[model samples]
Target: MSLNANDRSIAAFTMAGHALVHWFETSIPIFLVVWLAEFDVGVALFGVVVALGYAPFGLGALPGGILADRYGTRPLVLACLGGMSLAFLVLAAASSIYAIAAGLILWGIAASVYHPAGLALISTGVEDRGTVFAWHGIAGNAGIALGPFVAATLLIFLEWSVVAAVLAVPGVLAVLYGLGAEFDPTAAVADDADAGPDEALSPAALFSDSRTLFASAFAVVFVLVTFEGLYYRGTLTYLPEILHGLPAIESLALPAGLEGIQPADYIYVGLLVVGMAGQYAGGKLTNRIAPARGLAAIFAVLAVLALAFVPVTASGVGLAPIVALCGLLGFFLFAIQPFYQNAVAVFTPPDARGLSYGYTYLAEFGFGSASIALGGFVLGEFSQTVFFAMIAAFAGIGGLFAGALLVGGDRFAGTAETLEANADD
Candidate 1:
């Protein structure tokens, strides 16, 4: 289908919004080491403080979805941008740990609104949703890649406070851009005329029939997302620190005034940069492949990669091999996003896309936040080997659920086709 100028504009704006949301959220990890040193807190305690931000980021999604449904997505998107910008400004001004926690809490609440509002806008507002979602995923991955690079680079020249304030600028600009943009909430549903009756129900009615939703394929998707979230939050929370300890990275030659920056920082950024391709590829696959099958394949690879990471790190392998491993790991880790996102759209009614995404993120991010502390505790008390093994297990479990989903989906499709055939008689 041909996209009009308005459609193109909305997609661009939405993608930009996606990038900013991720940039703000992921940048915090890059600062985690700094905070730990500055505050003299234990890793586990710091993890909890960070979770204060992330937990809200996930928990707030449901209400954010509900609000987006009641109010227009445009306003909620604007609020998210504006509020996040202000939250960073708060972070920049923070004088103590309490102030920092306060800033993170505000940031989390602000960030929470984005996924529900943004995904709902795309899933419901755009006609070329598969393509749009792909582009949106790319934008998010770009933010994930750049957040640390930008934050790390800025820290070289400025205080973390100034760096945070600088980061807030994009959100301010997005807020301004959104104010002038035009969008049609009904455009998304209109594009899919055959949407089921359940798709058209309000949130309350949808909840009333929650049993039907859970009984269907969506429940399996939910389980897969939860495990995926745990893996994501667990591994990524301390990746930079993990990389920092690698002896190979410490020996790399560096330029003057850049000596303080670890090689792992550069590698971390590069790995995420590679994830953009994975996001694009995954998006394209969603158009051709069944979501559950795609998820199972990707998660299986992720499971293997997660298990291999510790071995590669401990092998005394050169920097190149480790970097290559990280690159592959990054690709599979992010590639799963678009597939599962598409899965949610496939399994749920179009009208409830917001709610579906809301719950999806709640599983991915809200419950996912627990891993931050868990990882910290694991690392502090045990070892990296155990941590990697745990992450591998999470991915493996997710893959199993995805496989089950594939089987269940096939059975359901067969049953539906048979019922339709009988009705025609």
Candidate 2:
């Protein structure tokens, strides 16, 4: 096959593998309490376990980017997937807490391998940057949207071990296909950079060293992405636990039909679906309104929803309204992604694009690791409601910062007004 066809197929496999891990890991959050009971693990340890899964992802992303640039996306992608499938297969037989944590950590390492390279591949491979990137974004979010549902549905009939084992199959398939493809863009980059103009392609650009503007923009986005991961992780991880707490959703939570309706499960599913819708909405509004205005609006919504989380915990209100609110919350929550992506895309340079992508995720998964720890601590010590409420504050602050970046200065502001003017033409 031609490079284009090969790239697309590889992209599909890469994305699918990435999404499967995303979906598979949701099981941890879904079966949080169950795992506790089955293994007798403590909350702190639980948090550590969860955090460890993502800890490597934050640390490994940049290097992975460099490696993908040095090696080939085709080989790296397949090896990573194969490694992850091996990790999941380990999950099926894990008899102790340490074993499970080990599996998750390895799996996380494996999962992190795909993004930087996969993105670089797609960005360089496809001729139209916009169409390819938009599709890539949609694929990622769609994975986030679908994985939890697939996980939760399987939970209805399978043991956690079975579920863990089953999730490995897709990765195996991804590896098989990935190994057969040939993509050598990084080699091309190496060759061209050597022969072309003496542009400064420093290692610092890819590693921890970032320019001032890039650093500032990265910090702003760190907050945004941290909250995004926190929200996504919390929703996927806690919904099942929340469902067990509320008898209302047991009937409705499953695909086969919830044995009962756990209003919380409905809320979880609602948030995901709404999040998917919100991404679409955000995409539509990004060019029409300044990202700052949209971000401000999103933050405002996140803050309200975060606070709302406490009341909706079935400790105070019924599940139905919370379920509705979950959908509403998701609508605004997931919509912020494009705005975030666009903001970063606008600020980053071509040479250091890998570093930019890596650090963006470093902020994402680093805080993600921390957030899981925090969520586990809170859920173990306090109410899930309170845990969620605190995240609201985090999400709110992140959104506010993003908004400020968009419009507070001469840099990102007045687009809303300008767009309005453009509409008149």
Candidate 3:
């Protein structure tokens, strides 16, 4: 279906917003090594600080969703961009470790609003949501990849503080664009209008009537998302450090004037860049495949790849093979996102989509934050082998949940179809 000019405009703006938010969020990890050296903190302690910064990204999502539903997505998105810009400004001026921690916490809080608000706008406002979501995912992956690449490149020449300030420019531009943009929050579904006025906005109503949401299909998806969060945050949080330890990457030849750049930084960015294709593929898969089955397949690959990472790197294999494995890992890891995101929409009522995504990210980011500390401890106390094993276990559990969904999702399929039919009418 062809989108009208307004729909295209909204999609473009929302996609840009996605990139801006993720750019800020993902840049933090790239800055971690710099912070570690400057602060002289141990890995475990730094992990805790980073966890504090990341925790709010999950913790604040539910409220962000509620606010989006109550106030409007455009304003919340604008607030997210503005608040993130302010947070980066704070980071640029930070002097002490506490100051840095505070800036990161503020950044986390500001970043938390984007996923629900942005996704809600696309889910409700766009006509061909799956394709739009694909483009959105690609934009997010661009941020994910570029955040580190840009930060790493800047760090080679500029101070980290200056880099922080520079990173806020996109948010500023996005805020300006957001202020003048027009979007319809009620364009996709009329579930809210169909409900009793009292029930439409009542949190009590949301909970009391959430049994359908917590039934077999949604419950399985939640479990799957929780595990995905654990694996995602656990692995990606320290990936640069992990790659840095590899001798193969360390010995690679470098170009002129780029001697200061770490191989790990390049590899980390490369992995995320490769993930952009995975995001697009997963998005396309949503139209051609069942969400549950697609989730099961990709997650199963994630489990195997997680287990293989340490072994492959440890085998003293050359840089070429190791880099290929990293690329594959990136592809499977990010490929799971679009599937589960689509699954959430399929299993929930339209009026409650914001809440659905709120809880979805809460699992993916909130519980996922625990992995930072857990992974830090394992890395500090035990070994990388143990850490990768734990990540693999998380993927394994997530695959089980996806498999269960594949077996049982048929019971809930009608919920999405009925909602879609209602919207079409």
Candidate 4:
């Protein structure tokens, strides 16, 4: 079915907002190392800064979701963009490590506000939530995947402050475009939502009760996503810092301070690019393999890739080819995101979609923050090999959690079916 111009515009608007959020958010890890180096701090403190920037997604998820349900998703999303733009401004002006950490915390809190509201809005805004989410996943992941390059490139030329200032452009534009327009979000929820169909419970009410099949489904996915979140955080958050001390990399005869440019970044980006490609392909398969199996497989691949990272970090092979292999690993790791997103959408409802997604993201970031903090501390205390090995172990643990979802996913599916039947009754 062809979407009318308005829905198309709305979808575009949502994507723009999502992209802007990702643009700034992706820079957090890279900035952690760059700023740390510039500030003359121990690399172990990478956790303190990164967590300050990332942990609030957990803290704000529920409230953000509730705001979307009670008020409206549109205004909330625009507000988030405005907040994000303002955050970049603060980050640009920050001086001391304390100041930057504060800025990151504020930015994290504000950015966290977007996911529940924005994701809920997207679930309603577009016609096919699965495809819409796949695109959303691609857009966000691609930004994350590409952000390091952006940071690295900027680091090569401009000051870090200027780099942040430059990245602020998209967020400001998103807010402006959103403010200039208006639409019936209720209409977007479902074609028949305006007719007072099945969507009775408010986002808050649904959140308060939390018994829907969708909510239960979210619980199972929540555990797995948490595992993925930890693994996710360990993967890129520690990348540049992890590679900082490798003996082989030191021998590359590269100039001082630019040694973080391992073949790994290319591999990581390649993996993400592949994953983005996978999201596109996986969306097509959501009806066949199921989001459960797809997510499980995705987690398994990420675990393997984590192990692969150990060697890539340790082995001092020539830069180009090893990096290419790294990218291939990333491709497989990233491919499963669409399935995870679709699973969230299918299991959720129009009203509380915000809360479902909000909580899911919260699970991801909260654990991710803690994991990075602990991982950073571990790196400070032990060998880089041990550090990478621990992250790999966590990946294995996360995979086990994700795999259990494969075992239990059907139960939630059955429960959701029963709830729908009861809701119908």
Candidate 5:
């Protein structure tokens, strides 16, 4: 189906918003390498520092959602972009670990508002929900891949702080662009009788609505998203660093003056690049298969990938086999996202879309942020094999939850009409 002008506008805004969010998100791991080398800190301690920022990123989602509900997506989105840019400026000027922590926390708080606002906008504003989401996921994956790629590429020629400063410029431009963008924010929900008044929910009403959501299939989705978050944060948070240590990656040669270019970084970028295909396929697949079923299979694949990651990297076979493994890992790692994202929309009412997404991310990022600490501790105290084992456990647990959703079938909550409404023609 062709997108109308409003749908295109919303998709464009969201695609930009989604890309910027991941751009900052994936770039952090690249910075982590510099911080580790420069700062006199252990991995475990530094993980806590990172967690301090990420915790609020997730924890604030609930309130961010409430704000999105009270105000509108555009205002909150503008706030998110402006705040994230300013936070990066602070990071660029930081002189101490404490300063970096403060900057990360600021960025986390600022960036926290994006997913809820952007996804809710798509859910309510875009007529071609699934197709837009596919594009949205593709944009996010582009950011995910490009953020680290750009950061690594720039670090070769510039200081990390200067690179950070340069990265902030795009958000400033995006904010300028957003101010002039036009669209009806709630056009999809305009005709729905159940969209409720465009006003703030009372505390009591909020509680009731939240209770209703938790009472439904959204509850299962919450669990599934949380595990997905754990696997995501656990793996991606340290993946580039992990790849850097491999003999397979270390053996690759670069030009003499370009010794600063770590092949591992590009390999990591390639992995995320493949994830763009995964995201597109996952989004479109939701139109054909039950999202829960797709999630079940994807999570199962993730579990196997996590278990295989260390062995494959450690094997002396060659870089080809290792690269292939990372490629597969990247594809499945991201492919699961659209499935769960679509699931959230199907399970919740349109009126509470923002809050629903807020809670969804709270589970995904908030509770999931703890894995940073957990992963750091595991990597520090145990071997990389053990660390991957822990990741496998997270994916395995997520698969089990996905299975529960599949087995429960229509007995799970969510109105049938929502499924029909969201189904692609």
Candidate 6:
């Protein structure tokens, strides 16, 4: 796990970028509560508004991957940081729901490129890939936790608009750092005959590369991540809002200045803070175990947690048990990330690494984000039990796909690059 200079440099830059991405992403859920009150809209309508932003976050991953492959990770990474900062500034000036959606859409488009670019850079550049992935997840989890904490705290003093404008500062600083940061993006892959991304960006080449990718085990990983996305977005998007309604959270009180903060917001932040551990554990676990098995096991745990959510939250037993459940939920929710990310690397080639990650996230964020709308509708129309049940189903289905990979053994578990090397021999 000891990283040399290049690995450290890549890790530092990617970790900063990783944190910023989630900083913006996780903060939105906190904003959801505010948006609900300020916009005076029903949950279903507002959900669509959020989806307008999030859908593009997922939908744009493919082109982001293509651009990463064609142009290199640095430029896209820089653009992602710069664009996201500007998008939030746009949010600061928004006067209506439409303007908010426009700002979010811009943010999504800008932020969407980071994962494909950052992960691909690590997969190809960093020497200690799993270690870096662990650190990367930790950084993102930091943002996940801190973003809400900051937003919740700021909402105590400033308007949501000013808070968003304030949030833009870190990303702007990150961009300036990224501009001068140096590392060979292809360093680890340089020794391999097939390491570089494909040069051609033609439509036929794009189609062919995608076809070659889906013809392998990566296709299953894609489906698994989509379900991951569904469960993830569906559960987390309204979590603070959901928790705020809980008797456990509602009963709590804070001191004078902090009194404006919802007790549930703290719980939400606690859950995400615990995820940093889950992410690190998952990342380390990827090096020790089969990622497919890990994915299956983690998602199964998520299913059980999802099923337990309503029962636990509504039990009226007290804050301790609910807080514990949130802890477990936060942990396992993020633990699946590194497993699936490693699975992508195992199932695809270095040359197509960017596109593989692109498709992977497209399934995860793009298709998964639809659950935001679905969850909104479900929450609007049905009971909490039903919404959680839907989340359980997403987790169960994802677990099943991972189980298929486990059952397939080497036929599906073998790395694509290894098979290609063997075929060459």
User: If both were scored by TM-score, which would come out higher, candidate 2 or candidate 4?
Assistant: 4
Of candidate 5, the 10-residue stretch with the lowest lDDT total is 416-425
Clash counts per candidate, in order, are 1, 13, 0, 5, 0, 0
In the range 187-218, model 3's lDDT, one tens digit per residue, is 66645563111223565555543454675377
User: Quick one: how many clashes does candidate 1 have?
Assistant: 1
Please give the CA lDDT of all the candidate structures. Answer: 0.80, 0.62, 0.81, 0.68, 0.85, 0.86
Candidate 1: pairs in clash: 124-188
- Best-fitting candidate, scored by lDDT: 6
Encode model 2's per-residue lDDT on 1-425: one tens digit a residue: 12355445545654565566556555556656568878876888887887788677677876766566556455566767787888888878999988888888887888776676665555444433333344445556666656666667787899888887887887788777766666444332343332111134346532333544343555566567777777656655665576557544443445556445455555566566566567666755665666556667777777777787666664645557756776777777677766665555445433444555666666666566566667788889988768878778777777777776675434533322332232233
Give the poorly placed runs of model 5, Cα more than 4 Å off.
28-50, 92-102, 155-162, 193-198, 253-256, 412-425
Q: Estimate each model's TM-score.
A: 0.86, 0.72, 0.88, 0.78, 0.88, 0.88
Of 2 and 5, the candidate ahead on lDDT is 5
Regions more than 4 Å wrong, model 1? 1-6, 29-49, 93-98, 155-162, 191-206, 253-258, 410-425
**Preferred candidate (TM-score higher): 1 or 5:** 5
| Model 5, span 1-425: residue lDDT tens | 78899999998888988899889987887898999888898998888898777778889898888778778788899999989889889989998899999999999999999998888888888877878888999999898878877998899899999999999998998999899999988888898654533474577667767776776778888998999999998888789788888887788887889897778867887988899888888877888888889999999899898888777766766788778988998888888988998888777777788888999999888888778889989989988899999999999899998888888846755543442233212
Question: Of models 5 and 6, which has the larger TM-score?
Answer: 6
TM-score, prediction 2: 0.72
Give per-residue CA lDDT, model 1, range 148-211, as digits (tens): 7799879889988899899999999988888888767557677554222222345545454344
* 320 Cα displacement, candidate 3 (Å): 1.8
Per-residue lDDT of 390 in model 2: 72
Residue pairs with backbone atoms closer than 3 Å in model 5 (clashes) = none
